[model samples]
Target: MLVLITYDVNTEDAAGRRRLRQIAKQCVNYGQRVQNSVFECLLDTAQCRSLQNKLCKLMDPERDSLRFYYLGKKYESKIEHFGCKQTYLPEDPMIL
Candidate 1:
């Protein structure tokens, strides 16, 4: 399944800044970042749950925000993009 994850972390203090980096690091391990704070992750049920748990632990509920959009297996047809940033399939091979 495709999971679209987006987050907003309050960066008003040093601790908040650190939390933002920690959250982004976790996302980088599981998905590609589409926007500064949005990631598109292709994960199974277990993987999704694990990531969610990790994020929940790191976030300050009163100061941060997170959202998960489940886009099933056929997510390609569900996404539409029109921008200068070239988009690629999450399942496609990425050469670093």
Candidate 2:
């Protein structure tokens, strides 16, 4: 499945700044960041739930917002992109 995770953390204080960094770090662990606060992650049900759990713990409901869009297994045609960055399938083989 392709999971699009987006978040907004109130960075008006030191604690909020720290929370933002921590959230970004965790997102990087699970996927590629396509935007400042948006990530494209390919994960299974269990993995998605796990990531959600981790994020829930990191965010303050009153001060932060998080969203997850599940694109299921056939997500290719579901997404369209246009910009500088080229899009690639998460399952594509990398020869590096």
Candidate 3:
């Protein structure tokens, strides 16, 4: 299965970005840092869960925040429509 995970990290500190990078690397097959506080990633369900777990562990409860979107089949269609060669989509939700 293929998944597109887009995330927003709501913090401006260097530590916050570093922690997010660490967590992202753990689960993403590929990623692009959109800005200092946003990122887009491609992953599988297992990978997404692992990444989420890592993010939860790294974030400070009061100082850091994270939001994730699961793009699933729509992500694959977008990739193809944009000329990407990939042809699969995740079939499960990682948040469970």
Return the top candidate by lDDT.
1
| lDDT digits (tens) for residues 1-96 of candidate 3 | 344344445448888777667756654434554444445566667777877777788767677666776666456455443355433234434442
Compute each candidate's TM-score over C-alphas. 0.98, 0.94, 0.52
- Model 1 lDDT vs. the true structure? 0.98
Off by over 4 Å in 3: 1-30, 76-96
Q: Can you write out model 1's per-residue Cα lDDT over 1-96, one digit (the tens) per residue? A: 999999999999999999999999999999999999999999999999999999999999999999999999999899999989999999999999
Candidate 3, number of clashes: 1
Q: What is the lDDT of residue 21 in candidate 2?
A: 98
Model 1 residue pairs with clashes: none
Q: Rank the candidates by TM-score, best first.
A: 1, 2, 3
TM-score of 2: 0.94
Whole-model lDDT per candidate: 0.98, 0.94, 0.58
lDDT of 2: 0.94
Question: What clash pairs does model 2 have?
Answer: none
User: For candidate 1, which ten residues in a row score worst on lDDT?
Assistant: 83-92
For TM-score, the strongest prediction is: 1
Off by over 4 Å in 1: none
